[model samples]
Target: MKFDVAVVGASPAGLSAAASSARTDARTVLIDRDLTSVPNANTIFEGMASAACLNVEPFSIHQVRGMRLISPSGHSLEIDAGGHFLDRKGFYAHYLNSAADYGAEIIESEVRSVSRSADGMELFLSTGDVIDARIVIDAAGVDSQLASSLGIKTMRHPDDVAWAIEVDVRHPGIGEEDRFEYWVGSIAPGWKATFSPAGEDMATLGVFVRRHGRDVQRFLETFLKKFISRRAGSHPGLERMRILGTRRGGDPIAVLPGRIVDDGIMVTGGAAAQSGLAYSMRAGEICGDVAGRAALERDPSRERLSEYSRRWWRELGFEYILGRASLERLRSMSDDEIDRLFISLSGRNLLVPGGLWRKSANAAFQLTKAMPSMLPRFLLNLLRF
Candidate 1:
């Protein structure tokens, strides 16, 4: 069958691309390996901070806000994260449903390869089905094997991918209002355990690491037990809850990749390496919108597909870049240093980097609070740098 654009992965990015493409009256086909969830999207997205959902702010997340960040060093500072924790299942269902509703056909099958065509591209799927489309949208996340074939770097920088393991545990202490707590200390290297409210009567406990590290799941499990043992010992609700399931891995927290498209194919979402945790929680809609327009224009050329890249750049790229860079830079620091610095950017604190000029006053205050003991040493590092 022929299509205006064949999106290879019906997750947030693929579906969004399909919806966007269909909106342009393009014959879009969305395909996935799993027949059930289409792209077989699964994960326990717990403990959402207001900052993670910034890209879609003022839109679906109409009334969302960020609060203070608590550091492991026993310091809490006020700051604004400016995002929303998603109603995860609702978020996915909403977008996937939107794509289907927009006259887009979503199929369950996997593509083997993309053969060149005079007009654009030919996708050969395992089902012996040939989908001829002017453009192919690769919204497949993480192990984007197809994207790598097109010369796009699908592998995230070593420090970018975080191996995670989470338990859909029910905790009484963590309620809807108190669902966000990030534990970062020396107990875990290059990672932290997160405690978040999944929804009413449910919560999730998980942990992650920047790159190849020790067993993250072991630490996560240990932390989960300790956290639960300490907090839920007396709460009757904690014992009543049964572990529904466990989810792990496939999160890339890094800079958004460049060249999401090449030749006649375009990439979006995770396949384009669009910060997994960030996009999984938000930004799929805009990414889909961008890829959809490119397909509708039927400009399968690299230049045309590059527009999709720019579209995300204006829409959600900046925030992703800033957030990714900030996190990456923070990851390079020592654990003690991180704990100390996070205390400054916490709760509605309005952290901004205007260099030493505009933020001089705020910097002064942070210096005092962040380094009461190592004032001279800290100033020396800042001065030398």
Candidate 2:
């Protein structure tokens, strides 16, 4: 089969790209190994709904008002943002249908090899079929084996990659107030543990660790026993909780790739290390539009495709950079230091990047009151280039 543009991976980014390209009158095709089993899809389901232009009401089960971060000492800080818990599988199907409705050909096959020639790009699939495209989009995600072959680099630092495991827990204490909880400093060193309520009496509790060889299950088990026991006295239903479903995967958490496009190709979504759902979708939108137009114009050169990278940075690059910096600083700090940092920054409305400038000023003032020695590091993050 031949197309003007072929998108690899049917992830939110890939689907959105296909949809955008097809809508622009480009003959677009999307291929994936398995479209339904998107590991990180649930990680940012609600945000993706808007970024990919999918409605969440049919699939969403709960609303999230904000995030709460807790330190080892139990000191906590809350940030307000609207979100929702969604039916992840349903969301993928919905996106696929949307792409198809926009006239994108959806194929369920693994890309065995990607070869570029003078004419265009040829993708060899596992089913012994060859698909051709004037331009190809690499949205194959963080673990994509095809990225390096295409000359796209992924996360560079070990600290930038995290392996996580999450399980569904049934507890009567789970509330409908829509809150996400983060346990730092104690649960998982270098990376934090998160609890997101999926619905009434059900929640997802997961832990992320920086090192690759570490056992995520053991950490999650220990955390469930220790942390839940600690809070069981206040919320008695925790003692009666049981696991419903479990999922685990390696997550690439890093700054966006330095370059996301090459001759006859463009990279989007997790494959570009723009792993956050909102960021990936927006980046995909830009890539798809640019690549679609480029394909239609019969010019898929790197120079023409560079606009996607430029536009992505202009829209959401700073947020990813700042977020990566923040995580790095947190990972470097000792548990005691993190406790102090959390305590110092507690009770302040901490919206990332938006209210960050003011929050940093307040954090500096409060750090001086609590742990004056760490003021420089805190200030460094806010003021660093």
Candidate 3:
């Protein structure tokens, strides 16, 4: 098979790229395993909201408006109350359909390797089919084969890949009043636990721990049961409670591997390491859009299409830096120390950090604003290097 551009991974980024490519007048072929198993795959999540944020709609950013940040011991803080809860599967389907509507052909095959030819790049798939394209885009998610085939290392560290097991919770007590709560603890210290509505009587529940170490299943069982039991206190019954389905997987956050392009090759999406809160979906859209244009223009070098990196940087580079640093700090922090630190920052409407020393600057401003009385805990946290 031959095309103008070929994309691997049929998920968010791949689908969006296909749509964008076709819209830009390129003959795009998208390859991936199978979408039928997504709902059951460890990756597809339930209770993941489908509502897009109204204010950010124009920008195509995906995130819940409000997130309830809870301390491991059960303290809570809410932020971005205006973000949308995403229906991840629905969103994926919406884009996949759009790509077809826009004229991209969907090829349900797994890519095995990339060999550049005189005319274009030759992609060898698992089924022994050879696909030649003017440009091959790697939009595959965390488990990106195309990115690695081109010698891009995907794993930054063992801890960069977050591991988790989620169950479709049928607990009666989890309700609208529950809000979207993210609980921080040893099981998932860097991030928070999320419990959002799955249906009238249930919610989707999951936990994430550092990619480094944890008995993932044991931790999930222990914490989930405890959470359900505590929240279900005084409820009519626990006998009927059950987990509808189980999902377990990891998503690694890291920079793109090596070069994003070589020969007739180009990369995009998470494969290009464009996963973050504000830029995740936008990465796909931008990648697809750019890849299509590059194919149409027949310019596949790092020089002509180097704009992909810039696009993501504009949307996420700085904020992602803070998140990355915070994630690192969480990994190295003692649980007790972290508990105390969160307690201090909770509920404070201080300025959000804007740069590398963002944390320090914000802390200083907070100290100045609340002087004399002295925020002892906050001061102690600020003191910690």
Best by TM-score: 2
lDDT per residue, candidate 2, 1-385, as tens digits? Answer: 8899999998778988998899889999999998767545553544435644556677666878878888877777887766777777777788789889999998999999999876899999999999989999998877776757866664445355677888888878574536788888766543788888877777888888776465677788777876677677766777678888888766666444756788888888877777766557777888899988999898889899888888887766666666666676777788788877777676654443434356545544665776677656655864653
Per-residue alpha-carbon lDDT of model 1 for 1-385, expressed as tens digits?
9888788886666666678678877787888887455222322222232334423332232222344344555565543433344455556666678888998898878888887788788988889998998878787676677867766664435346676777776555444543355666654434666656544556666777666563576676577665655456455555456777776655666645656668777777766666554454344555455556666776677787666667666655555555565455445567678676665445433456453234445644665675565455444533431
Return the lDDT, model 1, position 360. 44
What tens-digit string does per-residue lDDT give for candidate 3 at 226-307?
Answer: 6756566655575467777877755445332335655566666555555542345556677777778887888877666667
What's the TM-score of each model vs. the native?
0.77, 0.88, 0.79
User: Per TM-score, what order, best first?
Assistant: 2, 3, 1
Superior by TM-score: candidate 1 or candidate 2: 2
User: What are the runs in model 2 whose C-alpha is more than 4 Å off?
Assistant: 43-58, 175-177, 235-240, 352-375, 378-385
Ranking by lDDT: 2, 3, 1
Number of backbone-clashing residue pairs for each candidate, in the order shown? 14, 0, 12
Local distance difference test, per candidate?
A: 0.61, 0.76, 0.61
lDDT, candidate 3, equals 0.61
Better of 2 and 3 by lDDT: 2
